[model samples]
Target chain A: MIVDEVDKQIILATQAGLPLVAQPYQAIAAQLDLTAEEVMQRMRIMQENGIIRRVGAVPNHYKLGYRYNGMTVWDVVDEQIDYLGQLIGQLDFVSHCYHRPRHLPEWPYNLFAMVHSKTKTGVTEKVNIISQELGEFNRQQEVLYSTRILKKTGLRIGR
Target chain B: MLSDFYMQLLNDYQQDFPLTPRPYLAIAESLGVSEDDVLLAMQELTDQTLINRIGTIIKPNKMGKSMLVAMAVPEAQLQRVAGIVSSFSEVNHNYERENRFNLWFVLMSSTGELLQDTLDEIEQQCGYSTMRLPLVADYFINLGFELDLERDQELDREPDNGCDRLSTN
Candidate 1:
């Protein structure tokens, strides 16, 4: 992708994650020899372009007391995915939601949902609510919980 | 152009740092700032909720085996199911998408078989079917935004790790 100069700097600075300092942005600007406004502006552009999803910290849920979390997949009629997906996305506990092609034999889900909670019981309760609203789900729905947290960081810049 | 300070912070966060006590202090020293300043900035970010949490990144494949699983949970039972699904430590990220397969999450385990077993348990527990999709190929794009910052022309590179299966979980 042909990224602009200002966007490039901002990408480099944030890709690694923000510095641990009082004026981290200021520090980034100083090193880059650019004004604060310039940096912030570039970031805004990248966000608008969808090049950057959001400029924020990637939280470690495990460390933050979110012991129970699961990725749920569903097999719904292709036509109904969008309708149900939006409703599912609105749940506060749900973090990421998207539509992916169903990988047959091995993967049967056409829609995906992610949820985070404090305990297994809580997660089950949330699942029940979703089931009730939709009336019913695919014949097979699976929840995959996290056993270990691997790499969790922003994208590594192209450089 | 952004102030040099923010750039410095970005630079610090870009690499894997030493797993040392007082890691923030070391970062502060490198930036020629007091340790307190580093701590405060971090606190401010967290307070504002701009930062979710700071921690180590685990390499899933190296640790064992894992799979990306999805399921369509009924709308009425979405919340209840999520609460139950999250209870399992194996589920790392959970999202509600606008699709038939409404629930999606990543299941990481020390072995692929173990991951499957965990999914089975979830199906039995939630009374739903799950479709497991191990990553076929991944285009590792480390995307980040500066909100309103300008782009730098100097740092441009190509994507790394193409279908190697070694890079993804």
Candidate 2:
């Protein structure tokens, strides 16, 4: 899905956030000299093409009482990684799950799942649930809790 | 504690937010609330720093290339190294975690070449080798977090959840 110049403009305009108004699309269209219908159409097309994952209210997990977040990395059997990864990803507690490459001798975990909870105990409980689901296939695992958010500015694409 | 109305606004609108002309009105109609009420609630939520934004969550590697990179910084130089890394616009979500590879962040660029260049520059400035871990497969279908307001209410009653003191920032 190639994002043309117009699409790029739309992304830049709304990436920060859609305006808080009765007719947000119209406001964006006005900025770009595009019709409201065209703006909505382009966005819809982008959404269908997987360019736009979703358009919604992004909540701050920390402010929402999810203070404890652990990036739980697992060294699962390679053969069953996709199957197991899918299973682990579907859990309600897990937010971002991905199969990443492991730098052996230094890093040995390939599967990473970010678990968030209101309490540290809650995070451990969620990890335990994942462990049970993995069972014998779960060879080793470690949870890296973030102590400080050094920087957290969300993605910014410049023109 | 969040009101039930606000909870509904947060829970239901996390994903599949209206793409219509009057999205707020649509939400108001669906939630059986006045459009102004919905608008005010959303504004209040944004003001409270609860709602980061009402916008699109772009898929990684779609508009540009991105990868999660980690570097092990000495405790003494952690702050300095993190400052250098975060100085680059490409690097977002820099965090100091509890591990040997303490400094972790995600880097994104419009092109692969630019992404590599940023990574190289970070290593040079920070004086530490970085572990570039790009996503091979994403298993999670992001449906947004399901907030359990009831559980949160229960937790509010507890004496200490370790994070009693909120940062003013």
Candidate 3:
């Protein structure tokens, strides 16, 4: 991410998360001495460039009543897991989906997805839906439930 | 019930919030409120910690390499062990799960070699074996959830100050 001076100003200003005032851009513009239009344009360019992922609030699912956090791992055919992961990820019930390297014997699951709901049963329902999605391709599966959140700190930039 | 604006902001704009110069103005227009009013409400919601921030959520492994690591520590040493792991600059998140494999954390780095080296260092320091699950593939990874009003009060937690300075790894 090669950010120029103006982009740096924009990032340093907004990376902590966007300010929440009425004239939010103007507020950032004042600090950078760039026009509000200019600041927005720079951020838009950054987004297009992948410097910014998406502009919005990242809801704390736990805080949103997703009481059960299940890490669903699946043993799918290697060649198919990549394609299967994409299909499963598009399911509304799936919050997070990934392809992770598996540790053989002890951990033979290569596909991973995170499912969350308000209760354990709610989580099971979602898992069942996923299992059905995987069907014959899923050789085996395990749902690892998070017991305690030992640490939940998100990286804060420019700290 | 969620305030009309709250529903609109949290539910309607999950996937795409405006990227316009006056983004809030655009939001305000849709919500039938003045731009300044929308700004005030958003700030208050943020201050209230209902939302993390009105900014970007970078997808992991998008820019740099990262891995999910697990360490099996005896119950007695979990805390001290976790502290050591969390202190490392590269450790993004440290978690405790239900299995015998209790301690898990994430590490993101500029290179894959750096990621391996960090995991090795933790294994040596903590005296416990580690499991590394690197991002071999990404299925569906993104975040957005419309608040279920029925569980609003039940879902509330101590809203931590989120804007405090933290480093971007």
For chain B alone, what TM-score does every candidate structure achieve against the true structure? 0.63, 0.85, 0.84
Colliding pairs, model 3: A156-B166
| DockQ of every predicted complex | 0.05, 0.59, 0.45
Residues B90-142 of candidate 3 have per-residue lDDT tens digits of 88677777776778777777678877888888888988889888776665445
Model 2 TM-score, all chains together = 0.92
The local distance difference test score of model 1 is 0.56
Cα lDDT of model 2 by residue, A1-159, tens digit: 799999978877877899999999999999999999999999999989887878888876666778888899999999999999999988988888889999998899999998889899999999999999999998899999887777767667522
- Model 2 regions lying over 4 Å from their true place: B151-169
Q: Sort the candidates on DockQ, descending order.
A: 2, 3, 1
Candidate 3, overall lDDT?
0.71
TM-score of 1: 0.49
Instruction: Give i-RMS (Å) per prediction.
Output: 13.7, 4.2, 4.9
lDDT by residue (A54-100, candidate 3, tens digit) is 67765545555555667778899887887799888887657668888
Q: 1 or 2: which has the higher TM-score?
A: 2
Worst 10 residues of 2 chain B by lDDT: B160-169
Give TM-scores of chain A for all candidates.
Answer: 0.80, 0.94, 0.83
